[model samples]
Each structure stands twice: as structure tokens, then as C-alpha cells.
Target: MAEPELALDPIFLLGAGRCGSTFQQVRLCETGNVWIWGEHSGVLAGLFRWGGEAANNRQLTKYVYPREPVSSAEEIETLQHDGRGMAWMNGFRRPDLMAAQRALVLELFAKRLPPGKTRWGFKEIRYGPADRVPLNLLRMFPAGRIVHTVRAPFASIESAIVAWELPTVVALVEQNDQAALDALYLKHLDRWNGITGYLLDLQERWPRKVRTSRIEHYEDERRELFAFLSLEAPTGSAGARIFSKADTAGGYPGIARAFAERRERFEARVAANAGRAGYG
Candidate 1:
């Protein structure tokens, strides 16, 4: 009788924007049974502005994170709201999105669930200073698996600026021919600090259920990522190779350099933490 409908296990794909949300999500869906919807960038586009953040998010992605942007704040004095949740224009959210988009997400996940495939996941760019979304997501799906899509900072940011449309910000903050040094430095500082802070925070709170992966090495890492998800191999899919492109013409050379620096710093952090966490 058309087999029983599958019960879905929701997945929340998070991390910085330029970190490979779209391609990763697309690859995850290659299993041919799960529903995939990763083409969203509203959260990052409006991190600096509060005007119509939810509306903007709705437009960019059918899946929404927070009910509003004003609610999410990492540096803004964190207030414990019984039901209120934090939002980030540049990242996922503080405290997580469970209390925010839980209902809608659960509903969608349930409706689009694949038969006999209870596990489901989504990829979203969570790059703002605040990033408790993964924690929030875990709460939502207690048995869910998180694919912490990461990449080298330089390559990641460079790819983000180009593939993900953060070039203008890069130009402004890189003191490129497009913007002044002050603007470039100010934004670059924010970008670097935001990314560094978020990644380190994740490492500190790295949940046992969470699986960390570097997208720059998607060819090698994606196999592990999908395998953990119990997803079929992404053969003939876009994830088979990196979206390699030469850094020619006008681009965020400064941001690219900063990304490289950030990666080095994080690599060290991971190494130190690895020992402490007994990750050999």
C-alpha cells in the first residue's frame, strides 16, 4: 500500500557562508531519496542590518532560521528568554533556532521525508559571531548527525567571496581598488574575528554526534561525510571535485591572505584541542 511514509530525522547544516553550503547540500541529496534545499543566503546578507531580516531570509531560502534578526546577538548582552531565540545576519544564531523555526522545519522535514529513510539534513551558512545553531539543531533531532562543513580559511573565504557573493564586502574590507583601507581593515577584522571565534567555539563544544569535515578537500572528505550520514556515494555529483577557479582579475587578495592566516591559527587550535579531546 505505497509503503508507510518515512519518519524524518532533521539535520541542520551550519557554519560560515563561504564554507560550501550549497554544493554540500546538493551532494547530500544525491542519495536520490532525501529532500535537499541548501540554496539560501539571507542570514548572511542581513547580519549587519535588521530591516526585514526574516522576510529576506524567506526569500533567499525556503527554510528560515530565526523569526527575526534583532533577537540574535553574540556580543550584545545575552539575556535568557524563556522562549526567545537569537539570530545572526552573518551566521546561524546564538542559542540555536529550535525555539524559532522548529515547528516549520519539523513540519517540512516530516512532509518531505523519504520512505524508510528517517535521517534528513540541511546545509546552512552559519558564520556570524554567534553560532549555537548546531547545538539547537541537535536538540531538535536528538539522533541527528551534523556535517560540520569546513575548509581552509583562505580558500574558503576566497571561494565564498566569489561563489557565494561576498565580494563586495571583501572589496570594502580588503582596501582593494574598491574601498579604503579603513573600511577594508574594519570589515576584514570582523570577518576574521567572526570566523575564528565561531570555529574555535565549535571545537570547544564539539559534540560527539557532530562530524567535522573540511570542504576544501571535498573529494576526500565528502565520502566520509556522506558515509557517516548513511548516504549513498556522491558519484557523478558536483561534490566529486572542488569548484576550482584561478584567482585572476579583481578579487579579495587581502581577504584571501587573511583567510590563510586564520586557517593556520585554527589548525593550531584543532591540534591542541585534539590532544585534549583524545582525538588521535
Candidate 2:
């Protein structure tokens, strides 16, 4: 008889595209238990490599997202009802590639996992991950953790410019325009902010199950983090290789610096109204 399959549900990392996703992933992968499939997980990988194919419809709402009402364009996305085909095309330009050419990148991480209990998961840079978790995979791993991390918006936006490498319409003659830069900045803000709202909802509803931690504060919470994962606390000797990289990162000092030197009057006004709509 064959051995029973190990469950493959994963704790999720919910954040924007260029916000040190690789850094967080490497940190987690070094833990020796997690199987980190970076960014190329599930049906989304289909869009990145191939053109499109209809997969099963499901909603995944356990990941982070904003708490506003869904718009018509958002409504039409239908990750559950329709599985969002256009989402696939948006990631990939090619449409007629063979399965071999467009195969899914299903990397099962096995650096130091114990046999018969290969605890692992996807390390994806995703915006709509919430659509996949609550609606689908959580059915299996109900205890899965969610880390909704964020970086300073300006830093993320500046990185996005390098990653996208394009001049906006307003910059037809001018290579870089302030308006386009601002627009991209706001877009990332909206995207990650939406993620924040979803995280709030998921945590509120399942406080014990879905916890909150940040890439910015990993160091202060290392031992607590391992306890949360149910792993034995590392001794001084093993600690060197385990948390060396994460320890040196420190925190968002730049963000604090920016917020510090800015106008406080406007901040007080904004904070008062931010939660006026309230949470779900």
C-alpha cells in the first residue's frame, strides 16, 4: 500500500509586488520546515507562463485586502464564479504555448523537512490572494498563518519604476513625469491598503487561527515566531544560521524619519477619519 500524502496547505505572505518579497521568502525558507514556492503557485502560475485554461472556480479571502465594498470591475473578477480568465492573460502575453512550454512551476521545498510530514507552502507576490485562501485551501489547513507585510510606499514605488521600466502616457516626451510617479505611488497604496483591510477582517473573525506579524518586526519576534510555528526554540549554537539575515535587517527607520519630519496637523485629521467607516 502507498503512504498517505502529507497535507500541503501553507501559511500566506500577503504584500505588494516589490516590497522585499524575496527577502521575506528567503528568511522563511531558511527555517528548514517550510517549502517556499516563490511567486509561481497554483493557477496564477498558469497565467505567468502559459496563456489560459479554465480551472476550478473558488474564492480565497483569507489573505490581506482593503475593507471597502467591491466595485463593479472588482465584482466581475469572480475568482470563485468565473475564476478570472482575464487575470491570466494580464500576466502572460502568449496564448498558444504547449503544456510542456507552459508547465506549472510546482516546486516542493525539502531542504530539511522530516519525512512523512513535509509541511510546506507557496511564497507568492500576490494582490488577490485573499480570493484563494478562505474560499479554497483553508478547508484543509485551518491553522495556517497569514503575514500581511508592507514597506514604505515611496520606496516600493521607486522600486516599481525600475521593475516596470516604462514611461507613462503623460511622459511621451519626458522619460519621467511627477504625475505618473504619483499615480503609481497611489496605485500601490490602494492595493496594499486593500490588503490591510482584508487582513483585519480575517484576523477579527479568526483571531486565534490567523495571526498578524510584519516583515519590519521579524527580529523582535523571532523566538515568539518559532513558538507560533510549533517548532522547538533554537539554542545559541543553531541560532547563528537560522536568524542571522533577519536579525541584521532592523526596522523601517526611513519610514519613521519621513513621518517624523512631515506635517502633524494633516496626520491627525486623516487618522480621525480613517476608521470612520468601521470594520466588518
Candidate 3:
């Protein structure tokens, strides 16, 4: 069978939860021919994990079939008589496996496009450097572009805790446990640091393929972002709705207090990493 041709190269919008990724998606789609889908809850990341394992396994590499099949009867006979022949766990060819993986991904993301939409992609918050998702995804779609969105860590954590209704964060706030809240901030800060560091590395490695945007500066960066993706920048504030703040219903004051108390810690961590990421 022949390999399927993808109509458009995929674009991955990656960020921690509560970042303005959805806003970015909306703006990208406003170009009229792009359809950037919502998060699938790390489904693609899970698939990439499986592919990475199979691709790197030493045993699979050693036993996998040759790229070209043996045509000669003498070669077949030699293989049949050899102590380590194709009969023992005859594995698949890596190229075939990769092609199959690409086909499956295209079926999921690109096959069903809305009318007038020729490009397709998705936004995901569950993938970070630790998951090796970016590396594996680039392997699958070398022409793919990644937009790494970021928000102030405290603001993001505060919004995520409320948006997701995290039990631990709720309990800590209810108990008014200042120390626990500080610790929590530090924990999330470490994770954010790691993700930001990885994203910076990606931008450096693939300067043309990776771009980073901060939520607070989205308005200013909007034109540049559209141009980066080769899309015509839309006029007017059609995306104002996406930038609207959610109604935290008087609950954010408490959350704000928790974050405020740990402001120094947050600043220190951001200073250590944000400068390198060009977010400072």
C-alpha cells in the first residue's frame, strides 16, 4: 500500500493547564482555513510513549526484519538454518512502524476537517519535557510547529486549582495553611521550571519550528504569532471573548492571598528560568 499524504503539517500548542492555549487556538483558527482542536487529555502523549519504547528497545532493534525482504531461496535457507533466524520473535521494521503510527495520528487529527478548513492540529496541556512528547512528535511530523504558551506560574496554578477543583489545594486553602501553600507553590514552580527549560531548548534546537508566547503578552504578540504560522493576521477583536477572565465568584481573593504570601519564592524561581526563556 502507498503512504497517505497529509494535507497540512500539524501544529501543536503546548502549555501547562490554565495558560492561554485555548485563546491561541481560537486565534489560529480565525484565519479561516485552520482547525485547531481542543485537548484530548494526553491521548497523543500516551501514543508517543508507546512508540518511543518500541523504537528504542534494544531487543526489538536486534531482531526486527531487514528493510528489504529476502528474495533468494538460498538466503531463506540460510535464515532457516541460522541459530538466530527470523523465526525467533520476528519483529516489525522500524520504518513500517513509524509509517503506521503517522497514519493512525492523521486519521485521528486530520481526516475529519470542517468545511473550508484545510489545516488541523490540537492543543494539549498534559505534555511536557519529561514526557518526551515534543521529541517524538517532531519525529513523526518533522514539519510540525510547536507554540509553547506560558502564563505567570502563580496565576496559572491559582486558576488551575480552582478550575480543576483540586482537593489538596482546596484543603490547604480551607485550613489556611500558609506553609503548606508555600510548599505547593514550590512544587509547581519546579515543574514549571522544567517545562519552560525544555521548551527553550526546543526553540533553540529548531529555531524556525518552535515559538514561545506568554499569555500576558498575547495581544502584542498576536501578529507575530500569525505570521509565524504562515497565516494571515485577522483584524479586529473577534477573539475578545477568549481573553475574558472567568468568574471565580469571590473565591479568587483567598487564592490570591495564598499566592501573594509566596510571591518572593515565585519571583526567585521565575528569575532563575524566565530570563533564559526570554519571558522576563
Candidate 4:
């Protein structure tokens, strides 16, 4: 086994959660020409959060917050246990954290990349506009590619609702009340709007570095996607389909019909922003 040749333009698969990106990740990994780690968004995200490159409500005392003296052992213990002491102990700086994160990311990929393979990357679901991973990745690999995977809005929302343990679209129909179903539809519609808005912002900001693909037309766009990734087309056992519509939300007739009924509400948004991604 020889050293895997890293790509000048590593790839990042981006999309809303439950949008069929796992299938794409598996298929692309099957090519054997690219080393792709699936669902390790947290690795980059942790570094981002530590570095103040991204923000979340989860942390009560951020490193960027005013430094408070903790002379007492009890105060020190409390701060450490409360998640604010590590940054304080480190002088509220993140250079060491940033270095450790980069080294860890590289080591993880090195362990995973097959010998003689180049062009390694990862697939992560949406991390919002403030995420530092995208820019951090670019700094690490200036020409890195960002591929946004899209799905039909209704199907995506339906899939997301179920996966996120929210009420399913099917349940709305089964409840058999028009107002209830309509309200469910509206809720999902709002969720999808946020998703598409984020994607559109990324696409616009990184027009040259970013591209979109639709899950619906993945079969047709398979070759182009591989070519874009600088991978050879996969065949034989590796190329066999690993994902099936029968296993996903779209397979259910009732759910499909429910989505269709509300198609008009989301169709215009999709057509306007997702057309390039192959969603109509």
C-alpha cells in the first residue's frame, strides 16, 4: 500500500439532513477513486465552535465572553464542569485547539483512505451559514468543491419530519382533519424554506466552488458527478445500487399523495432556486 494522493480540491457533500446524501456518499465512495468519510460533520463543527467561528445557544459561557477570575477551587470545579473552564485555562485562545483539530482531521482521513487513492473528502448535512468548516476547508484546500445534494421539497420535508421524530406527513392525513393537515403542511413548508435558503446562499457566495445535484435524477447524473469529483465510473459489485426508493418515504402511496396535494405551495420555491439542482 502506497500513500494516498490528496486532492488539491477536496470535496464536501452538503445537504439537509435526510435528503438522500447518505446514498450519494456511499455511491461516491464506491468509486474507489475518492476517499470519503460519511457523516463526520461534528469533527469540523467542534473546532469551529471552539474557535468562535460558529455560534450555538447550547453553550452558556462562550470563550469569547468576558474572562472572570476563578481563584477558588470550588469556582474552578464549577467552571470546568459547566463547560467554560477549558477555554479559560487555555487563556481563551484557540490556536492549540485549531492545530489539534486539523491534525485529528488529517489522521482520521489517513486511517480511512485506501492505499494509492487520492481525492479524499467528507459528506456533512447542513451546518448553517455561520459554520467555519466551509471556509476552513477552503483554507486547507483552496480549490475544494462543495456539492449540495437536493431533493423535492415535499419529499424532503416528509423524510425529514419522520427522521427528526416529528409527526409524519402520513399521520397528518390519517388524522383526517383538513385544518390539521394544512397546518402540518405549513410547518414543513417553513422548515424547507430555511433549508433551501441556506443552500441558495452557499451557491451564490461560492458560485465557482459550489454545485448542486438532485437525488431524483441521481441515476442520470451519476457519471457527471463522478467526473466532477475526478473519479472513474464504478462497475460490478461496487456499482450496484445500495439505496432503494422502496425503503424511503416516497415509497408510501398515502404520503406521496399528501405531498402532491401541497406541491403548489413548495413548487414555486423549488423552481425558482432549485431548478439548477435538477429539482422542478
Identify the leading candidate in terms of lDDT. Answer: 3
Query: Which whole-number lDDT from 0 to 100 does residue 117 have in model 1?
Result: 49
Worst 10 residues of 3 by lDDT: 241-250
- Top model by TM-score, which number? 3
- Misplaced by over 4 Å in model 3 are 1-5, 65-68, 72-78, 89-91, 243-252
lDDT score of model 3? 0.75
So what's the TM-score on candidate 4? 0.66
lDDT tens digits by residue: candidate 2, 103-185 = 23223332334453366655555545345433233433466665554444434433444345333422421443445544554
State how far residue 37 of model 1 sits from its true place (Å). 1.1
Error of 1 at 62 (Å): 37
Q: Where does candidate 4 have its weakest 10-residue lDDT segment?
A: 53-62
Per-structure clash totals for the candidates: 9, 13, 0, 0
Window of ten residues with lowest summed lDDT in model 2: 57-66
Per-residue lDDT of 81-199 in model 3, one digit per residue for the tens?
66666464343577766877787888899966787887889998888777878777787888888999988666666566556655677688889988887787777777677777788
Q: What C-alpha RMSD separates each model from the true structure? A: 12.9, 13.8, 3.0, 7.6
Poorly placed runs, candidate 1 (over 4 Å): 1-6, 39-101, 112-119, 127-131, 162-179, 185-189, 192-200, 203-206, 234-241, 244-280
Cα lDDT, all candidates:
0.52, 0.45, 0.75, 0.64
Cα lDDT for residue 231, candidate 2: 54
TM-score of each: 0.55, 0.53, 0.86, 0.66
What number of backbone clashes does candidate 3 have, counting pairs of residues 3 or more apart or in separate chains?
0
